[model samples]
Target: MSFSNFLSGLKEKTNELKDEVLKFKNKNFLHAATAGSALIAMADGSIDSAEKQKMLKLIENNDALKVFKTSDVISSFTEFLNNFDFDKDVGESKACEALNRIKDNNVEARTVMRLILAIAASDGVFDQDEKIVAIKIAKELGLNPADFEL
Candidate 1:
C-alpha cells in the first residue's frame, strides 16, 4: 500500500480503538453508580422513594449514563437495588469493584462519591448505617472520604 493509504488506515484504526475505550469507560461508570446507589438503599433495610429519586436524578444528569437508554439504565439500577443484601458480602464485593473502576478514573471517583453522599442525605439526615457503609466503600476503593465531605 502507498504511504498515504497506510497512514489513513492507521488513523481509522486509532479512532476505532478510542471509541471502544470510551464505551468501556462509560459502562464502568454506569455500573459503579448503580452499585453505589444499591448500597445506600440497603443501608436502612429499605430504600425510600426520596433516596431513589435522588439517585435516579444523579444518573440522569451523568454523561456516562447517557450511553444507556433510560429504561436500560433504570433497570440495571433497580436490579441492584432489589438484590442488595448487606447480610451477604456479595453486594459489597460488586460495589467495591465498581468503585475501584471509578477511582481509577480520578474524576469519576469524586463524582460517584458526591452522588452517594447526596443519596445518603436525601432523607434530610444521613443515617449511621449509610455513613458506615459509604466510608467502608470509599476505603476499599482507596478514595478519601474527605473528598466527599463524609
Candidate 2:
C-alpha cells in the first residue's frame, strides 16, 4: 500500500479505538452504579471491607457492569463516600442525582438496584437500614419500592 493509504488506515483505526474507549468508559453508567452501590453499603453506618469487596466482585462478575475497569469502579464509589464523609446531605444528593440519570432506562436502573441489594446483603445480614436505602433508591429510579419488598 502507498504511504497515503497507510496513513488513512491508521487514522481510521485511531478513530475506531477512540469510540471504543468512549463506550468502555461509559462515565455516567459507572458513576451511577458505583455511587448507588456505595450508598446502600453505607446504610449500616459504614461500608465494611467485606461489603466493599463483595460489591467489587459483583461488579466484576456482573455482565452489565463488566465493561468498567476496577479502578474506575473504585474511584466512583470512593468519590461518593468521600462526599458523604464530608457532608451527609451533599453526598446523598449528588449520588442520587447521578443515579437519577439512569432512571429513564428502567431496566438498567432495576439491574443496578438489584446489584446494590446484593452487595448490602453480602455480609449475610441485610439490615433494615440497607433496606430503607434501597427503597429510597428505588423511588429515585422511578420504581415502586414496594415491588422490591421494601
Q: Which candidate leads in TM-score?
A: 2
Compose the digit string of candidate 1's lDDT tens values, residues 1-150. Answer: 999999999999999898777766688787788788888777877888898888888788877666566776687787675456434467667677777776777677767777788888888988789988888767755788776666
**Tens digits of per-residue lDDT for model 2, 23-110:** 5656767777888888898898888898889989988897766767798789889999999999989989999999998888888888
- Residue 130 in model 1: lDDT: 90
Error of 1 at 26 (Å): 0.6
Score each candidate by Cα lDDT: 0.77, 0.86
Candidate 2, residue 98: CA error in Å? 0.7
Give the TM-scores of the predictions, in the order they appear: 0.76, 0.85
Best by lDDT: 2
Model 1 quality (TM-score): 0.76
